[model samples]
Target chain A: MSASDPAGAAAGAPAVAIEQLRKSYGPITALDGASISVDTGEIFGLVGPNGAGKTTLIKAICGILKPDSGSVSVLGLDAARERHAVRRRLGYMPQTPALYEDLSPRENLVFFGRGFRTSGLSDRIRDVLEFVELWERRDDPLHNFSGGMKQRASLACALLRDPELLILDEPTAGVDPTLKQNFWRRFRELKERGRTIFVTTNMMDEALHCDRVAVIRAGSVLITETPEAIRARGRTRVTLGLRDGSLREQEVLAYEEEMPRLLAAYGLSDEVARISVRRPSLEDVVLGMIAGDAGAGEKPAHGGAHGGAHGGRTTGAHPGAGADAEDGGNV
Target chain B: MFSNINAIAVRINRQFLRDRRFLGLSLIVPVLLMLLLKYVLDSLPGLARLGVHISDYAILVAAYLVHFLAYVLSTIVLVRDRKDGTLGRMFVYGYRRREIVLGYVGGYSTIAAVQTALVLILTKYLFDINLAPDLIAVVLTMLALAVVSVGLGVFISNFARNEGQVFPFIPLVIVPTALLSGIAIPIDELPRVLQWCSYLIPLRYAVSVLDGVLNQHRSFFSELGPFLTLVAVGAGLLATASLTLRERE
Candidate 1:
């Protein structure tokens, strides 16, 4: 495989590398020795809960926020001292919508395009707007656009100069699911075009799209691995669904040593379903780790944003539970 | 550097055209204030209890308008941009903090220069106010006033959290400067203590420079000390503003 090719699994030179990053906001530590590297053309995902220092880390790398101690290098340039050159090669979409709301989408794109000093900027603006599929509404006031459209426009503005690196913070948080799917497709297309991207998302399912995932908690990274690696290390998960749905709540309440036995007595066997509980999901893994849950086998309930069961096909059961055992709520 | 400057100018002008309130301040507010200045200067004979020509007040008003326009409008626009995150956004896009400051100066300076032209043209042609001895000196003084006003705007914007906080500071700077800068209340008649207080205002130096240039027709160098002093004050404020940007970083 060629050096520039992104398809190869082996890591080449990292496009962006950070080491021993430390930052603090008064008494609260924002990043504690957080380090990660994004290889050339790889679409990396930084996964973490809120206040997990994801933004802090991104800001430090972007030179907008300074870390108390650490080093960040982008494409082999110092992030702090060489910020302008680094910025020249990167497109950043902040968590908050940073476009001028009063300006039309076209005007906003042109404005940011000018900032990047892109040659044939007007044409580049047109191409980016079309790429984001927002060309038709280019003349619409940004304030009038819906959340998803506004996000697409923001993406367009960031892509005005087609920088090599893209840093997006929850780029699809408020976007509708259909548009989000489209966004992921666009991200893959950009990845194919040899652009490196570092994205932060709380959406667990989106983790599957990333080449690698770094799960962070509090002010430190919990783990970083490929999606398959994370899933392969996944412990047993037996999501019990009761006919009445009331017994499941009580079973969760009596969840110490008794819940497992109760689950097994009802034919919820380990050989069949990999019982004895397991390490929680990406979200639970971080929260449980924060709560000092020891990463041991514990069937922590999944909540927050994933209220749906089975890919939007909703069922009247506790969230994320897949099993249906009716005889006095098997497990 | 120039390309960066062009980018900043585009953003500033885009903002100027898009925000209705800013547009009004840039175009209409200055014209209206010119008329108001004409009226107030016309009424000064009766109000001041001193025999002062509307023409004399007109010269002072021309100079003061430069100050007023620079202070009021620059404060509003700069403060709005800061509160709305435009200043922070500017830094993210390869712009030096100094470039942002100077680009705003360049954009607002263009606005002030054009408005100064109209005010002077109206005062000379429409109002029949005779030309002063040193027209270039007067123009340079007005330019200095513009610089001082914009510098003060950037300085004040650093402290203002939002548009609401910015509004209250307008009176804090404008009221005292107007009263003491020989615009309304002549500085000579005020007590010695208040006279010293007036000296602290950058506009006081601006008005003195204009007074020497237009009223006395002195060479610009005759009033060079105060002119350069005002420039220094403006530069000091701008430097402070650039330093405070570290907080945002």
Candidate 2:
């Protein structure tokens, strides 16, 4: 509720922490003993495939879903026991923009602000609308707005309370590239203001923007590490052009050692013409991990705070998109 | 809690006001239904020879109109709200189940209030009933019925997942009230088992009380017994509704 709110939370507590959280819908398990932690003032991303419990985890963090077992702590308060108190400290934007289609941006702001009992109503509404570049569209109804415009309006409502922690579920799913960039810019700006952000996105490039991302599959976290560290673990592709104009490609976890060993085996240095190397992208690495684990029931290799072993490092490329390509799930 | 309720109420009222067509229809439908009811009731054989004017039954029609319309309107709106994720958004933003049910009841009360006033005034003018003497009790009874209808709507909505799912419930609720609530058949004349089940219908109490003042010429205070029962049912429905309303998917 104030500039000092994030700091006012239980001192030294992480923004979010979940331990062995499990949830089920009838016979289908949504979250299977998933554990993760998010530090304050950092942008954390949760990456997963469809029906992989990305949303269920987000809801647990927001205190909207009670885990079948285990615990969730938000801002140092128990998520289930202190749901109301937890809600007061955070803002949640659902996968879809949940604004009333009949109400204008300004009216929506007023409604949410009143719900939060926010102070300085007029000033707060103006500031949020302007922050989201929605001031010009203040009086326009949401149903009349374009998709990106509706998103902006929804974001403005979420920020009305000046929440210490903001949770966005696929905030840029259908957003154009330019607006997607715009949204990340706003998220970073909020980050600069010392607010913690928890975003769930499957887009590889979007995952790159986070301080760290946790790849989840079948309700368990396959790995949690910095993008750079995870990227270092994937194999690099090497393409070779021979004197006869034939091109050969090879993938290696360590190109420095493997490339030379490969060339020596060919026994024809004079025949080598050209060479190019391409490292596996985050998407390729993620899909490889998920595929590797989906049918094998194999435990993901141990990973340290920096980077260690993760089983998702395998072969396969997503069709249509380049290895490193991003998808906004365009509308 | 009060402020949260007020915020939700204001937002809903704004939406109601903006859709002028829906608002106009809400007020007009009861009047049209009243005329239709009279047309059909007038056709019942031997009523005119028995010296009972068909218009004399307008009070019963008014009570049913309030119950049916209020229940249908509230149920549909709540189902739509849940489908749109606004209900989930509110829960994440700290709105409790009780506050949500109360807030909606508060919001829809705008339409209910105006509709109550319109039906009572039209019942007096169109039916030629001597309602002036017991105006306060009669109006209170009608308004309480509207409130109870709204509560029942909220309760029933929890059983439906989407707008399409509310269809089966429309007949499931409306038909029982129409047949067993004493307007179609006198309550005492029904079998004892059926008579006991009529007590479960809120409209039965409203009809009993409304009949007392409009036709039986009973003093207003004498009708308080059934009126209190109606209020008790409303309170019970609202509380059960709050308890049943899901805070999570």
Candidate 3:
């Protein structure tokens, strides 16, 4: 956010850059030419429904899966060719628990800490456990932990190294709302410290917390832009109530220039008893893209060469260039 | 690499110690089986004309039983870790395949050592077997067998899909190999083909080395060939295991 901005720290090298990544299993294509770039110190969110290839993309970036034909570079190093080096700079929290239920949280941290060869491991573990608010239950075996507690412990494992980039896959799934809020706060704090975070979530509301969001569906990223840009893809809806108990709703562009003309056209400028205007949420924006893609009968070349080229150097892009907001259905 | 291996080894040891059922199975079950064998052999009416010493047979059987136990324990632990994604998580954390394999070997080898010592001590005092003068040779032979068992367990775990798959391997691998290793009869006394097949079994060398020290009173130097063969087989199996291990199936 300032002179120490991670985006400016390395002018040319993006924190994560993927181009034309494709992966498959037999006949099922898990990822189809998905490409995106996450800038340094940015909280980039991958928002999509289940089976949208969010996990696949995260795995490819973490070097856990080798893409069939693509290039993935983390911190300017090839992820597949230089896996260990890339992994050393990353902390990944998998979708599943992927933990030793038999071992205590403290023991789990010790095991993973040694794998990363972390220095001052004890202090780091304690710090992360406290940060996740799991320090009091650190000695309990993970089997005894609730779903959210297990998730926090898993996050603590990734945080032990204080990595330069953290890749989390659905970190807030099944987590209580309070803990979910805490996680976002911690992510923001990490961003302030110049660490980048790449996270995936199906919860549309969660996208608001990220600096940028990539809307993916069925293995293809539909659009990648800032949260504000995504929200702007939906028009503001105005609800009008008449004196006779009749109700009518209308959609208008977000700009104020259209408001008065629309009100006059409805002949409700003086007769309207009540009026309310609300903008579309992220869910609306994603649903609009999905519906548009379905109607076009052709997949929007989301994050292709142009998207990739633009995404590489810029943090904010106009929503019109990607998905047309006027085409988005009524809010 | 060394530190990662050491950490994994320590973690594995703690897991084994915490699992009371596994501890009992690995340590107590074999001794109990040895006791049952001792009683059964003692009950049999055998004269001096037969020239079969029940105590010597007890030592051989005890060694084989303990060796097989080590195999089962190590395979179950390794396979469980793989199935649960713990090993995969470690890989994502930058731990290499060989480090994980070596960690397993180092950890289970500790269990093997304790197992060998416990079984030998229990059999020696419980059955009053005359094993004092050549105790070190016998212990060395058992320790060698333990190493081979650990290696075999880790290698076999790669082929198993789950814990249930591991059980079938015992009859297919351990039982046949133990039978051919002359646990019941001399390999040379079998037919020529069977005798030749015994050469392929590492346990044959282990049984031979143990027999020489405990029954034949041979020096460790005299049985050095079989001992070295055990160590070499262990190294080979471990290398293969490490190469076969993958993050996913």
Candidate 4:
């Protein structure tokens, strides 16, 4: 279900619920009235470009940041007021690899586990290291590990507490594709074990693995929908390669009706060397939404011209409407 | 809270153990300085004439060296933790700010204890420096100086953005405090205005307490004023450091 679905809200309290969180660094508003909800036992992806407030939102939800206004609740506890209790149930891995360069993976786990007051830490450390496939080299200092290995080690630290809600920021940014695939597999495995995952990433491909994705830009959430729903908003594009090494593209909402017309218009002529239909991906939908939002003159909600002293007015666009129209052209 | 402090302390100690060069340097600098002082004093004609025995200066120098080393080590480690996101990571893990500060204290204080003991033993055997009849008082005084150093280090670390920024603090904070705290010259020999300024430097109280214990053979209770002042200043600096700690901008 979408974050805004009333039925989902009625079913039970979400694992995380942020309402109009506003935070600013002088003139730069990091989070401008940002809001979203993540259901329990679901993997929620916050997809955004750099400076899109994804990290800020994650920090607020994790109780690392105190919003200037509004409220944040994690597992029905106020994140800002009841921070210690909320933090106990949440595991957070920051965007940067936060492991000590001189310490081994096991040592890092031991430190974090003790900080979280976890028991049977030695066994848990071994299990997490093995899960991340770093068991063989867990004894080596983190400085000797490759970027992917460091990322995996950081993930192991986050999992040391066996938290019910895991918040990971760009967990696979520098990781190899194979390791990224493995990380996703592990995330899915954790989900099956009744855990809720909130992850942030700029990679559109990564969002496909999440149960729901929130498209954030300019410190505002553009839309929240399932991967399939977001893809549905994207239209199929027909591209024709010409002999002159140039290409002509037409986006079609109804492939059956528009495909015939476009083919007939172009005909089986020598000028058109090849014609292919390309289905829209999540990238297209997200880009289309951002373009549409920009065209609509939506000021950056966080830390832009309208973000600071004046205070941003809530400008909630109809979620997914502009994206659907922009993607399908005539849907 | 204790568990969190212990865990962080263990992690910090492990990091120190892994960097053997730093550990070695921290332990050896004071000994080298003490040896250098011995040779210099033996050659100088005015030391005996001035009634300034090398033994009297040895305890003072040892106290100052231990304080300086503790300050440098704690500042570097804390600033590195800040720059590298370790401090932020611990904050995310639900560690209170005071606990993290205490963890640094616990870790560095352990090293300080070792360094103090080694310096005391080395001064006695290697330097042939005469010790006070009450060795425990001398040890307690040096440990207090170490605490002051750790507090000052952690406090100064908050102002430093990176490791490079930490260097300027040596000249601006350490050098002036070392010179003014009567480590090199007695406070009575300083200019009247400078003597007044030394009161503001916490190390002055530490040196005073050490002198009282080592040179005078005074018990801890006899040097209560300076001892309490040293402890108070260290506690004040640590409190400020904890209050200023923040995870992010």
Candidate 5:
């Protein structure tokens, strides 16, 4: 991360800026004033559990759904007012498979190409099809395509215009492991071409490859940080990974107060790695915070102007947010 | 707006052309239904008494074929895309909701016009029904009726969620509209409220327009009012359908 890197400047350029985005369906608050920014060419990930408002936020940005309050700007244009311009610059791959099953992949590409107002369309079509490795099956009816193949064609259609920003919602869901790896590799290739990608996912390992990420849950974004920073939340949790059957009883005893010194006395530090007592993962961090609040029958021990702003929970302002390692629990 | 409209037009055309079975049905189904109606009506004594005039039957055939094709196919196509996610993707791709509605209506109207023309020609030459009021008024009426039927199709598409749900609306909309339009029934003999419905149904004017063109000594304007009515109904339905496009399914 160079301080003034070109990519950094682009990432900081505010290709997409959301300020206090709020949406609701009667009583269900879909987006509770969530705010995030993406740089011009960075691949930013929005990872969260189900019903976390990722889809709602994406829909609002795409101009499919109207936000109740707050603002969304894409590439310096307001999404609601300049929807056409925003659509021209952005390519969206919806979570569901949206292609016409009766049409061949080539036909589908041609239709979408004409929609994007692209030139040299046939050549571009062949190029994108080849790029996605779906050229071999271009003539097959989409109804005949397997899930992975359909997804590839869907992506090919989205890339027809060489869009500046790509918003893919769970692009690899249900894809096999090998194809999933290929998909991520293709995403990296796209990033190298100076394209900004905004993706939503729940898989944490993939988050490691993202330049930055926002971990959201239940319509609220919990944290936004790099994978390294998130993992560094505490000293780093070390798992014992003990000899399978041999550790069950010991694992139960390790939770006991007297066992820490006893395990140290065993001289098993090499085989038995010490648990550094770190905060759980981004996923676990969110679940744990919510769980702790539920158990304590109180708020997250954090409440201030910024602490609970926009219906989101933030760390307390007093005592320096409790050393930044207090696991966000009042207990 | 026009580019987005053109995009949807191209998609609808490509979609119809790609499916051989659907294309065949689009071309053949209405003609077959016209022939089936002729046979069903000939068996009844009352319709048989309209002088057994080949020309009257031919005009009715032309009207029904145009009405059926416009109403049935448009609803099916629109509802199918809505059920799938293609409509949603199109919205994301810079297509204004109004363009989508207009595009489909325009495309379907074009197909219905061509098909109606062929049916009229077949009835005139092959079935020996005379063309009395020239080709121009007949063409105008067919086009108006087609637009009206397509409008009804667009309106119904908004309410259908899936293919299975779509077929039921066909009877609910098409049957009553067809029956009340005076295509299969005589409007004068019906009750007063039923007569008012005939005014509401665009096909009533369609049938009237056809009867005027085919029946000798009956001035086309005597039925000109119906032709104008069909056009007005179509425009009204189309406007309402366009407004509904702004809503998400």
Candidate 6:
């Protein structure tokens, strides 16, 4: 139940549970039985490359796109069957800052805030505006604002309802690193307040901000794991500085065990003056999983990646295996 | 639902107000068009001599102006909304298709009222017209046409993918309206087929109502048949718009 718990699996249904989703557009299938589970009060990331079904998955969860099969349950209610109920309980921020650019940030917030009967909406507007740090320029029209400012305003609108779950699609795609960091900061704040966030981001680095991330590619999820766990699966790179001034580099897996063996070879030898171990980044781990899944035909195309994968699974192959898919079949 | 609709309406109003150029132009264009109608009718003093009431033609022209402006503006604006994802955003924010449609109509209704009044006032002053005794009714009819035009605009916008796509529809609607709404020429003078087609045009009802009030000297209340037809067409178009509008992003 604490904020540190990524699963948030304490006495409540998972915040979002999507199962066996299959969506297609003509020759392209955006989601091929992609199943993902996000626990309550957690920040979940759906990471992938462009045209990786990330947007489709987000839309299905929001009940904006009816899945051809399977189910999307938000706060335990069927997303399609009870869309209005699910909609009332969740706030969605699309990839682009979908707002009236002519209106000021404050005006946008007020307009969106009116949809929900928030108690003391004016106070709530002030709070969200200040939270997004757009209160000072509240009346300045949005078109005049930079990309980052518009994003902050969009975030303010999405946060206005104070819904139990917030679904964001590429909330930080085009913003600068500082703004991206700022958005994540606000997301964490919302999570700390016991709100569940389901974020779809194509940027692998952004995945580091999520408590748990699901790596998807070509309408299929390849793996779901914490950033740390994914990174651990990546082989560490070891560099050795020898007395002869000749350097040696090696990719070592299970470095905890390999490091000792590697150092022992140089033990009692002045030839090995120094050593450096470069751990794999979370991005490498995730991209490896996505690429590995494409190579491993062993994984069924329709099979959902529901916590059932590792960073690398291509030791077994049918390289470039799954049916070719690109993201747009939005009905 | 009411709250959501109200919010959308208020937001639309705010956005419309900010675009002072469009707002000012939409209101002024109808009045300006009315003045042009006056000059054209005056130049046809021979028509008045031919036992034709030129004032009646002026009001029909005014009605056509109201419909054209409301239709064009609503279509272009809604197409932008759809293209820019505003409508889709509203859908994700829990607003229903019907609510969005009604909200948009409600939003434009206020502006249409102002436009309608402006055009009617100027039409009254610029030419010899008999809308004064029933000025309220005349305004209501014009406002009703504009609202229906808004609904029809929204409905047409659903078929368009972008603002450019919205223009092709203009000729589709305006041509039939001009030829079949009994405006440019009397429906009865046309072929029997085109006359039957006039009944299908919403503008025909508005034109019929105006003609009755101005030439036939029928009181606004007595022209209930065409007046109610106009209202019914508006309801149908609004409903059709709600149905056609995308429920998914």
Q: What are the RMSDs of all candidates, in order? A: 8.7, 7.9, 8.7, 10.1, 10.4, 9.0
Runs with alpha carbons beyond 4 Å of true place in candidate 1: A1-13, A25-29, A139-141, A226-331, B37-49, B121-128, B132-135, B184-200, B217-221, B228-248
Q: What is the lDDT of candidate 1?
A: 0.71
Q: Candidate 3 chain A — worst ten consecutive residues by lDDT sum?
A: A308-317
Every candidate's lDDT:
0.71, 0.80, 0.77, 0.78, 0.71, 0.77
List candidate 6 segments past 4 Å from native: A1-12, A236-249, A255-260, A263-331, B39-53
lDDT of 5 by residue, A1-331 (tens): 0011222223356888988998998899999989988888888989887789988888877877788889999887888888777888788888877888878888887776666677788888888899889898898889898998889898888787777788898888777645765676777777777778899887765564577889887777788886546644534222343555444233232222333544675574645433322222233344345556433212332222222211122222221122133232211
Which ten contiguous residues of candidate 2 chain B have the minimum total lDDT?
Answer: B36-45
> What TM-score does each prediction get for chain A alone?
0.71, 0.78, 0.78, 0.74, 0.71, 0.77
- Give one digit per residue, the lDDT tens place, for model 5 in B1-249: 787677677677776777888878778876776666556655676745756655566677677768877888888778777767788788776566678888887788778877887788777765577665457788888888888888788888888787777788877876777678775677998899999877877777877877766765476777778778788888898888888864442
Q: How accurate is candidate 6 locally (lDDT)?
A: 0.77
Which candidate number has the best DockQ? Answer: 2
| Sort order, TM-score high to low | 2, 6, 4, 3, 5, 1
Error of 2 at B96 (Å): 2.5
What ranges in model 4 sit over 4 Å off? A1-11, A231-237, A241-249, A254-257, A264-331, B125-127, B189-196, B217-220, B247-249
Residues A1-331, model 1: lDDT tens digits: 0113333223466888889899999899999998898888888989888899988988876778777999998877788888777778788887766788888888877766666566787778788889998889888888888888888988886677676788888898887655765777778778877888899987766665678889888878888887545544533333567776744434243223344465776776655432232223433344446557665214422322222211221112232232111211100
lDDT of 4 by residue, B200-245 (tens): 8888987887777777777778888988888888889889988987
Per-residue lDDT of A75 in model 1: 73
Question: Which prediction has more favorable TM-score, 3 or 6?
Answer: 6
Between prediction 2 and prediction 3, the one with superior DockQ is: 2
Extract clashing residue pairs from model 6: none
Once fitted onto the true fold, the runs of candidate 2 whose alpha carbons sit more than 4 angstroms away are A1-5, A8-11, A254-323, A326-331, B43-45, B50-52
- Of 1 and 4, the candidate ahead on TM-score is 4
TM-score of each: 0.75, 0.87, 0.81, 0.82, 0.77, 0.83
Instruction: After the best TM-score superposition of candidate 6, give how far the Cα of residue A147 lies from its true spot, in angstroms.
Output: 1.1
Error of 3 at B92 (Å): 2.8
Candidate 1: what is its chain A TM-score? Answer: 0.71
lDDT of 5: 0.71
lDDT of 5 at A199: 92
- Tens digits of per-residue lDDT, candidate 3, B61-151, equal 8778767877888898788877776776898887898898889888988988887787788788766887888888788778778777877
lDDT of 6 by residue, A1-331 (tens): 1122332334667888888899988788899989898989888999888899999998888787967788888888888888877777788888889899989988777776666565677877887888889999999999999998888888888878777888999998778644665687778778778889999887655565677989988888889998656655767577889999999899886555565567777774545433332222333344436656433333322222221121222221221111111111111
